[model samples]
Target chain A: MSENTTYREAVKRAIHKAMKEDERVFLMGEDVGRYGGSYAVSMGFLEEFGSERIIDTPLCESGFTGAGIGAAVNGMRPIVEIMTINFSFLALDQIINSASKLLYMSGGQFNVPIVIRMATGGGNQLGAQHSHSLEGWYAHVPGLKVLTPATVQDAYDMVGLALDHPDPILIFENSNLYNTKGELDTNATPLPIGKAKIHREGKDLTLLTYGVNLLKALKAHERLAKEGIDVEVIDLRSLRPLDDEAIMASVKKTHRVMIVDEGWKSGSISAEIMARINEQAFYELDAPMVRVCSAEVPFPYAEHLERAAMPQVDEIVAMAHKVMEES
Target chain B: MSEFIMPSLGADMESAVLMEWKIKEGDKVKKGDIIAEVETSKGVIEIEIFEDGIVEKLLVEPETECKVGTPLAIIHSVSERINISPAAKKRAKELGVDLEKLASQTKGTINLSQVEATDEKTETKAPTTDGMRQAIARAMSKSNTEIPHYYLSTSINMTAALKWLEELNSQRPIGERILPAALLIHAIVLALKKVPQLNGFWQNDTQEIISEINPGIAIALRKGGLITPAILNTQEMNLNETMHSLDDLITRTRTGKLKGGEMTQQTITITNLGDLGIESVFGVIYPPQVAIVGIGNIMDVPWAENDMLCARKVVKVTLAGDHRATDGRIGAQFLDKLDKILQKPEELL
Candidate 1:
């Protein structure tokens, strides 16, 4: 029952556990039935559920994603996998326009209880087209809960929470964090979305970020700690309906903020976060808002180029220190 | 006759191009009349005539760039005027002090150092560690030396005020910033209008009181230390004008570019430590000003109204005045008027 698990393995275990608890739960995706999965996160699910449940389909993301929405509306909980978020663009019409809007647009007549999981973020040398962190983009759309689980406990707990919700949910898993191991307990329950968790408590500045950037913020926190700067790392697991009160409370204490996001600088989630802080806690601010986001360029093919395109730990630390020294 | 030195309009200004002259060489002009237009860091501002007299000579012409503190013109009074020595005029010109206005106001020969001291006080210096520490030293020394300041603390319910601000701000643009500071300024102006004695200065030399409501607002700069820039005739100005004036003062103060006229002649002062979460503070009265008001942070506290306890957002306003000119009853009445005005902000509009 107990075993050493990576974030990816923890997610796979949560999916299998949910499937065993309810016969109505099923898995469907391209190559998920026979090829296990692109990352092997759903390796043995095909043998367990068979063809009737472990459904496979052609390379039509919009079709399968729409099918998943339809099945969820009919009282069957469906787990849909779109190999990577880059391919989710082809199915964006189904996920954003259809699945995300069905509940609100129908005035509560219909509910889309589907969990769409996708591989996100860069670090696997997965070239320009294959690697990108689109969590901020998905988070921009309303009526869909977006979750980014960076730890093993969150990976285990988020699946049950998504299944229990009466609306469509999107979960982003970082490709480079697949083998990162952490502790998890069986007694862990579903966590409510729209609430931020303070993973590390420090007094200097609050680092607001989510998804793969959460790990980068944590790394920056460690480096700042060595310089005698205690940084408060806030894992904003949920993006929309943000926990603004929590963010403001932390900002009032620290008097400074640095937002991190793996998205373009303009009109990104980091911008929205900083705007909220400015509106609510401007008098408390000692310095203006600082943002560390992905460079405003298309991801390149080379390894060094890709790393430069994404937000790094050094940038976050430098921005935090700069703000601290200003006031 | 006294020499009129060119006013240093703004910080970082070494010289100015005399744009246009509103008065001719022999034109008789009164104080506060626009004599010329000069451009500064902010915008084109009309240079005012600081004394009443006939313009004797025009030292600088239009299109001519003159250094600050140089004599721009000369004026002669028809009636008996205070005698000003040529050495004093030279010294005043060097210090950028308007000798004619100083002689007219003092009704005696004016010391150049007093003008220099006044100018020194007006110039914005980046607050160094020693300056702030010295200010603290002077403040504590004065508190212990001069007037005995008795502290009286009480909180007023601000639930109504907070709701009013929210409703007013919803209809305003982002530029017309409405903050607690604006509300406090409005309330204090109304109170001082009712009790003009609180706005008077404690003149030690003649043992006389001069009443004027030149309300000064304390601005804490980004770097350190503090500066009080006064808004003349606060009671006469409307709320919009008050807000505009305050915005102009704060913007200039933060950028370290406050003009000479912006700093001189304050009759009363208001310092807000509310932003820093100070519950209440007793500010030392800046000499000549009889009263100084301190505003505290707004917080929710349980209050008993109609024999029932309910949470209300409340702020404490403390008034420290010169007992030589004002008593406890006058101070209490002023506070009551301020509280009433804050509760009914529409009257100020």
Candidate 2:
């Protein structure tokens, strides 16, 4: 049985299922209890699980994130939520140095089985202070698993899988994707952490993306199909430990690649993926690898500027045309 | 210093025995200078250097057969030890400044003032066109002196071929139309494919049949001399592609833009003297190649078809083959195949 639900409800149900199954599981973050999550993801959770299980902390990201990591180390499974990725910088040291390195530093005696979820990306007219996407930064850190769930099914499955992981895991939810609706199987099995999914099969070119940009890429694929330009769309569900096998296989078949990234172009994840493709599958490419990344400037407050700053479907379609036209 | 490796002269040329060196160590060489002679399956070819340099070391001894890409010598660039500003470099090129002489006179960076002083002091050289004629004289004399040649001629009826080509060209624009020369080259390629023995080199007391057919087209330059640069891999081209390549090759050859591989990679040569109103020609086979096909003027000649004497457009075709590699029978077979192909010119398309 499958249920049609938004990404927010799918995540809320995954967390509720975890809390019901595991006594060690508890939710902790600012306004997670009384506020029912800053995005209303935990509505009615406090009333059902009570104050002890659905606990909310003061406005301090580093303090509560550190407490959650410490609790996980002491045999408690805690899901820590940050209101936005822009504020996650306040807990960068705790997440990178403490939570990520604790198991290796303790000689595998203590494991930081903590899960941190942060709302990321811009498109909601949120100013630069609230709308930065820092998932690429977290992915650069070793010893930490990074997951970006774009679809509702992945949102539900990835959360359930991240809680079962022994090491620290971070799930970056694109802020604009919470309202996007898709089908979620009631008994959906958890997807493997580092495997990518091919949403469409094509022979002309491969379009790689994740998070909210995946939707735009799909729309661009539809537009390109009308013009006889067949495109393959792949969602890189995991940022760290990228699926090189899947990426190379698509490159071998299509012979062209266009990466769509919401992050800035310079030193971004898209650059890293291009470097990897050049290193491993250089001869398979017929045309140079192209990327459509966000503008280097910070997120603009105006809706028009924000839309222009981010990579859009039209830009993706135009870039696909340019790539196809090349050898 | 950069190593000068043995280049693959043709598609089938894998290795070459170093026969002689035209330059020794400490010799200053300019680009396009014949620095060495290497003997491959196609006979001794004069190898040209592509950079202005001084010979630093000789790596391969004469008579040593080395594989392609084996370093034969090391050449140290003349300008490597000297620093010249961008403006000075441009001025030197315009003045044809002798960098070696300028380097001997100065130290540190060579600037525009030094270039101007050198240009004023040195005598400017006059342009000469006799060098190409002299090179052709040496190569043709070598071919006449070394190889025993045998010649044969046949008359091919071009009435059908010309009519077919005229109809085909009528449908296309002027620039995209095919010419009779392209059809002739295509027919020769097809004939070579049928009688493969004549489409190769006469080397080392035997005939070496090359896998790919590269026919050198003898195109006369506008000035006084002529060059025969091979249309590489003619076997793969159709009539239209053959026409395009022939046009491109002629333009580049006249402009002195032919590449080194085109100069040394001919399996056979084709010389057409028809445009000059010559009734017949017995061409000298370019050395190392076994045969040369010559096309003469197409004229209205008396023909007896089905015992009826009538006028027909016919062309005089001649083949000169190396007596050592092939015989009169092979040349006759090739000419026959070529005549049959021209009878159905649409097959070339």
- What is candidate 1's local distance difference test score? 0.80
Say which candidate scores most in lDDT.
2
Error of 1 at B134 (Å): 7.1
Best TM-score goes to which candidate? Answer: 2
Among all windows of 10 consecutive residues in model 2 chain A, the one with the lowest summed lDDT is: A280-289
TM-score of 2: 0.52
Docking class of 2: incorrect
lDDT of 2 by residue, B38-113 (tens): 9999899999999998898999999999999999999887767766654466568888987766775555566556
Q: Calculate the i-RMS of every candidate, to one decimal place.
A: 21.4, 18.1
Mind giving the per-residue lDDT tens digits that candidate 2 earns over A35-115? Answer: 899989999999999999999998899999999999999999999999889989999999999999999999999999999
TM-score of each model's B chain?
0.60, 0.66
